[model samples]
Target: MDETLKDSKKLISDIQTQYTRLSKGQKLIAQYILNNYDKVAFMTACKLGETVGVSESTVVRFANALGYSGYPKLQAALQELIKNKLTTVQRVEMANDYSDENTILNKILKGDIDNIRETLEEIDGEAFQEAISRLLKARKIYILGMRTSFVVAQYLGFYLGIILDNVHTVRMDMGDAFEQIVRIGEDDVVIAFSFPRYSKKSFQLVKYAKEKGAHVISITDSLFAPIASESDNTLIVKSNMASFVDSLVPAMSVANALAVAVGMKEKEDIKEHFDDLEQMWDKYGMFE
Candidate 1:
């Protein structure tokens, strides 16, 4: 079991309580660290300051206000908190606190809840919005996911096609996808979903799309993913859970969010499309 930190949650909550008391520079540092905890947890004070558009002194001040000796101690504590809470492999496995049959349900629910919550907390809002915008504007949208992730890709493709035209879901057949890829142009976009133990084919497809000048957005679990290196924008969804099997809850949530954002972007079009479908269904007595 991981050693309990010295009231880390209380410390974080206290910092949050005094949020309004922070100076402008310190506030910037504080907000940045809170929003990007995963990144800041491992970063040095100078790197944290640079990333947040603040000075090193500002980072130190923010640390001191949080009741730490200095930035390093605060960073260490934050790292421990992150290591305990974040759904990464090493941290989550080490922190597993469940056993027995009744605890199985609790574990699953907690894992799903944690996955969604951490994903939302860790996501970069600007990046997410930008990805939605790109998908909305693209002439053709191609979605690729293999194995378990295929379900999310299919769901997105199905809903997105209802809202917008020219949405393609790439299947596992490499030849079929290759043929489809040839038709994609600079104005097109490809959304690829791949997590840890990522499919090589997904990486290849993303690379192929990039080479063909298609904007590629990747939804993945790690910065180390092969697809991430080739992706135009990567949305990280931390899906670390108990059991070696991956969970779909976080991926589905992200896909649903993307679908909603895309639908909202083309609200009128989606409305008209659904209206026509309803009319056609009634005319054919399809529901009766």
Candidate 2:
């Protein structure tokens, strides 16, 4: 197996290339996986073995034969392969198969914790700093995120707006997302939030920003993500599948961190802005 070929899309090719040498038991596992990867990606090694009529050890051996360190790594690769491709119905089905109703809470919480840990470990510090630097220097910062990702984009835009005067949260509700960023230029920074089931509009927005000579910063789940290729700086954040919805806990943490980092560099300005806002709110009796 070519160790350099780690892309999830190539995993299938790798298996096919090595199929001639696989044992009968390994072949069964591979065949089942090749046929039902979306389901197998969420299955336990034991479950996969049972489905293929093989022993658990055979499944583990199959994974090793495919060049993964263990079954978990292979499973992750499978998940990565189908993450953006799974439909909502398929995601719900996969979640039901993987989680027991009696322990759904425990499994979900633990999974989210693991996602956060992985994101911390994998995040690029240089990219993070460069994103901050660009945000600080940008003549205008446009934030784009569609569907569920819009929530995180809104939060980031809100905080960045407070810290900096030139933040624009691209509102798809107003009109076309492209129209919102049509004026983007070399002095602009487009910070895009994209994850699995990635949006076409978000991808196009970033691509246009890059073409216009603007700095594009992508906060997404993988280096292999479409937006990453169009970005000046890419921040990888781990996101988990929570039934039909993609969990954004770690993505939100990254947004919060970016806002804080930018704020830290302009604390004096933030303090002044907040102080004036506090006075206005107090005068208007906005809060008890």
Candidate 3:
């Protein structure tokens, strides 16, 4: 475990255990930090205070209450947590001066490598394998994502279609989503994605899918995310970032792994399909 993450986990666990003892101002700071750990990690004391409607002194007091020497110490700890949690592109962006391209490139490369390394470390291999198995066995797979996460849904739908044949990526059209999900049944599986500032419509869709007896799989940043509570299995992807935009690299990687696992599991079937495509490609003179 990264030392920073270890500290953060300790802090969070401590806060949860002793929450009732916190002062009102301290509780506000705690809630803000817990809800927006990435933002708090990167923000200045003045900025965090402004957002939380608290004074800078209060922020410092809150840090002290958490057993830190002061606000800067707490900030340093948060920076480490962010570094451990954020994606490569995100961390690079955080670290860069923004005016220097060469420096930015180096940082970006380092961040990507670190992101992949940490992702491998954080993922529960057994749970992931079980998700793949469930997906493979499902009679149909319904992928649900909205807003930024829709890109993930589309990618999964496209690749999984080549292998699974019964994959559906829900469109943004609300009526269409309702109509499609209504038809899902007990043997179907629903994979839903939502993150911080999660979509209400996505939650509703997950609920509807569950009501229809489909197994729900959720990919989200928080265990407390509304969708996670209802999911048959939830894959937690760390989406924390310095800026407003959340990174999708981890989610995309998870989706890719699922597609590959499913394809490998049905290798004989996929091989026949690809073999037929190869002959068609030769016939059409599609490639040199």
Candidate 4:
């Protein structure tokens, strides 16, 4: 689990439990959050303090009082509370509050940059190397991600398939998700992509893979995420919300890194495979 994470529900409960002991300004801040957590989840410390009619310092103190390292960790706890619960309409409403047309481009790009930065800073290097080792040794690899997560899974599967054989990208259109992975065994590896609005189908498949003795690797936003719990190796890549959509650039970047790293390990074999592929493509005129 992310050492930075406080249980979302417990955080709220603690706030209520300590309401009577809070200073007058802290009580106002707590009251605002208690009633409007969804709104506060996306706010900056300065913005939250301003909304509560208090100085930003008071907000930081309030977060510290709640046992968080700082205001950002507290804000992140609040975000976890509503991450899966927020509807698309609610996300769009939040987008309106956070950005305008004039600033949308910069705001979204900045958020994506921050996501990558945090992912790079917080992701476990040892776990990442271990995941690569597992993939290299696996008899077969299965990849699954539903909804928006499918985009990331597809991208990773495409590259990994080229680098290594027997890579399966599970798609619901082909059959039931369970059927797609039913043959998983101890020698197999299942890489699951899970992000905000986490997929129940994906989580179930990952759990099933674990039960069948397959190695599980999860590329997700947090270690506390459902799929992460089932994974043998959890790759924590940040996907902070950017407007109505979850920012996926960070996840894609990591996927690319993984593919490249794996490809480099089998460089001679891949070179020969690509050479044959190029000849076949030339004979068929597959590309202009």
Residues 1-288, candidate 1: write the lDDT tens digits: 111245444656766888999999988887876687756766789988888898988889898887777887777566545542455454445434456777978877888998899788877798798899898789999999988889899998998888887898997655667776778889999999987557888888888889989999999876556798998888888675455467778989999999999888888888888999999999999996
Show the lowest summed lDDT stretch of 10 residues, model 4: 1-10
TM-score of 3: 0.70
Full-model lDDT, candidate 2? 0.88
lDDT by residue (tens digit), candidate 4, 53-114: 99999999999888888998898898877787888888888877555675988888888999
- The RMSD of every model to the true structure, in order and in angstroms, is 11.9, 2.1, 7.3, 1.5
- Total colliding residue pairs, candidate 3: 1
lDDT string for model 2 (1-288, tens) is 112226477999989999989999999988888899888988899999998999999999998998787898888888888898988887777766455665887877888899999889888999999999999999999998999999999999999998898999998789888888889999999999999899988888899899999999999988778998998888988886877868899999999999999999999999999999999999999999
TM-score, predicted candidate 2 vs. hidden true structure: 0.95
In order, what lDDT does every prediction score?
Answer: 0.79, 0.88, 0.78, 0.90
Task: Give residue 41's error in model 3 in angstroms.
Answer: 2.4
Question: How much RMSD separates candidate 1 from the native structure?
Answer: 11.9
For model 3, residues 178-208, the per-residue Cα lDDT tens digits are 8877789999999998865678899999998
In candidate 2, stretches whose alpha carbon ends up further than 4 angstroms from where it belongs are: 1-5, 97-102
Flag regions of model 1 displaced more than 4 Å: 1-101, 173-175, 285-288
Which window of 10 residues has the lowest lDDT sum in candidate 3? Answer: 1-10
